[model samples]
Target: MPTIVVDVMPKAELLDPQGKAVAGALTRLGHEGFAAVRIGKRFELTVDAADEATLATVRQIAAEILSNSVIEDVVGIEVVE
Candidate 1:
């Protein structure tokens, strides 16, 4: 099986309320560790396709249906061999 990893993050221009709220709470929790922390969503994809072409198709599907290009970016794609 081939696994594809997907990540979605808020754009730099857009405001992230959830991230900001978490930052606020973290700061208040006495963990003033990092100056800033950006949070995003991650996923692991499982596919039975065994060819590169099919894998490409799956990637495209994930990009089109699983992600939004404007505000979020795909941060990683790791293929386990």
Candidate 2:
């Protein structure tokens, strides 16, 4: 079996309150290495096979189901063993 990983991120123009909160916490904890942080989502889907047809279907699922088109973008989709 193979696992498909889908990465989704909020649109660049939108504000990510969760990310901001994390960044603030990092700063307060003396972690100055990170200038900013943007939170995103990752979905792992297990499949029997990693074929072209399956990949296409996964892409469609990533775009239409896993993420909101208005606020989030499907950044990446990859197959992992």
Candidate 3:
């Protein structure tokens, strides 16, 4: 089986409270080199085959369920070993 990966992240203009909170915590914990953090979601789905058609279907699924177009962007989709 192969895994299809979907990465979802908030748009650059949108505010990410969770990411901001994490960044603040990182600074407090003495990892202060980072200026900002934007948390994102990755979804993995295993399929019987890794083909172009399967990839297309996974793209549709990610667009419909894995990400919110209003605020989040579907960065990319990949087939992982």
Candidate 4:
């Protein structure tokens, strides 16, 4: 089986409260080397094959179903071993 990985992230302009909270926690825990943190989503899809057609469909699915176009962007789509 092959796996398709989809990475989705909120638009840079939008504020991510969850990410903010995590960043705050990191700072409190003495991790000051990091300036900020932004959380995103990763979707792993298992398939029989990783052909071009399947990849196209996965791209569509990532844009339409896996993420919110209004606020998030499909950052990446790739086949994994």
* Top lDDT hit: 2
Please give, for residues 1-81, the per-residue lDDT of candidate 2 as tens digits. Answer: 799999999999999999999999999999898987999999999998999999999999999999999999999999998
Backbone clashes in model 3, listed as residue pairs: none
My TM-score estimates for the predictions, one after another, are: 0.79, 0.96, 0.95, 0.97
Order of the predicted models by lDDT, top scorer first:
2, 4, 3, 1
Stronger candidate by lDDT (3 vs 4): 4
lDDT for model 1: 0.74
In angstroms, how far off is 7's CA in candidate 1? Answer: 1.5
Pairs of colliding residues, candidate 4: none
After superposition, the stretches of candidate 1 with alpha carbons farther than 4 Å from their true spots are: none
> What's the lDDT for residue 31 in model 3?
96
Note the Cα lDDT for every prediction shown: 0.74, 0.96, 0.92, 0.95
What lDDT score is found at residue 4 in candidate 3? 86
State residue 4's C-alpha deviation in candidate 4, in Å: 0.5
Kindly report the root-mean-square deviation of model 1 from the true structure over all alpha carbons: 1.9
lDDT of 4 by residue, 32-56 (tens): 8877889999999999999999999
Ranking by TM-score: 4, 2, 3, 1
The residue pairs in collision within model 1 are none
| Candidate 4 TM-score to native | 0.97
Where is model 2 poorest over a 10-residue stretch in terms of lDDT? 28-37
